[model samples]
Target: MSQSKSGCKNAQAEFSRFAKPLVDEALAHAAQGEPSPDDFHKLRVALRRLRTLIWAWRPLLGRKFADLERAYLKRPAAAAGEARDWDIAISLLGDEQTKPDTERLQTARRDARARASSTLAAADLKHALREMLRRVNRELNTSPRRTPIKCLARERVRAARRALRKRMRRAQRANRGDYAPWHEVRKGAKRLRYLLEFFQPVLRRRESRRVKSLRRLQDRFGALNDAVATEHLLGQHREVFADAATADAALAALKRERKRRRRAARELLG
Candidate 1:
């Protein structure tokens, strides 16, 4: 084999080694008729990690193709996210769990879980995941553009870091009440963290050193997301409550939690 072909095969082999377990884990959970919280979480996480891997390879795969694949995966991602959000919101209710509101949320959670399970079971979704993997590996092995994997990894990881720094600046300048920029910051940070983790073997020692800080950043940002996302999810059901007063009380609780979590997230940035 030519040098490029040999290198490409090596890249394909290493990536498959890393990706196959995640695929199996996701597929195993998807096959379950009724998935537990942990199973659902695993399914969601696996899908996201796969998307991150796609992002890493987009340089070789072409951005448009990568974007399309990610978009196609979003339906299952959304369903799983909603289910997880319901669980988080319910957990946030804490001592209020005995109240009727908690029961209402639990009922919603059941529906969300069923939807996620249904999405996971969809023929198209299953085919899509498998096809994505097959196609990606095939391209890695056959594509004429034989970019060295190490060079690609370094370039993309550095670009990810730059993108994250830009997002952080935007978040810092954002108004206290406006979380959109901050949300972008959180996503950017997550993408960078994934890139670093996945490409660490090929990246410089300095790049690997950022993992600890990235973990801390992801934790703070994720806490903020939990609060904001829970509030957003619960807000949609404002009219579901039989009594307006109870609905107001439930929502008020979420607002307080959002406020508290946002503070911690903001403090971390400063």
Candidate 2:
């Protein structure tokens, strides 16, 4: 991987070059009726990976590609999310005692498990995902080649800074203390990290280290987001469980876990 004046451009090109074959093969396997679960899973992983690469390189290509890629990805990622949530919810059943509202939570978990299972079975999620992958591949191949890397980098940075400043000001108004400003700071940090990572040619290891620290901060926020989202999903299906006790317990456990996560984020930000 020789460095080019346009590392972001090269990175995007490499991602496209490698992703096409992987997606094509995965789609073929899924269409074969006897698609192995492993193969299907591989396809999903490939899509996620490619999407991540696109995210990291979004400064190079601008928001259009980002929007288009995300549009194709939303459904597939949602299907995967449902399956993932079910897996997590079901595991909670076995660990009910460790959680605060074990009895109630278990009930909720059971209900969630049943619903998730039914949804997974009825939905041709793999088929839809395969078709979506096919479409994405076609789109990528035909997408425009030129990327205004320098110009886009300047704009992306400016936009990121503006958004961060706006958010920080709001947070200050709300009196969120340190957490508010920290949250806004991390957003700016992430945009910088992504931009630098994509534009690797001019980026140095010292710069990479700084960006890595910012990424750690971003990760802390991401964890909080995940827990909140997951808890809501589990809570929404609480009525389906036969045991209210288990559901309540699970919800309580999730609350504590969420709190713990928030504290961790605070520590990192601080």
Which candidate's lDDT is highest?
1
Report how far residue 114 has shifted in candidate 2, in Å. Answer: 12
lDDT of each: 0.75, 0.55
Q: How many residue pairs clash per model?
A: 0, 15
Candidate 2 per-residue C-alpha lDDT over 1-270 given as tens digits, one digit per residue, 9 for 90 to 100: 444455445333454554556556545543444333343455555555556445545555457866676556544544545545544554444463534344654565455435544544455546655564455445455656754344444455456556655664554454432344545555555656665555444444465566677678678765655566667776787754556786677778777777777777667633
Q: For model 1, how does the per-residue alpha-carbon lDDT over 1-270 read when each residue is reduced to its tens digit? A: 443443344454556766777788778877777888888788888888888777877777779887887776666877778778777776765644223354665677788888877777774556677887888788777767556666777787888889888888888888888989878878888888888887766667788899888888888888888888877876787654546776677778778888888887777676
Segments of candidate 1 deviating more than 4 angstroms: 1-13, 97-102, 239-242
Largest TM-score belongs to which candidate? 1
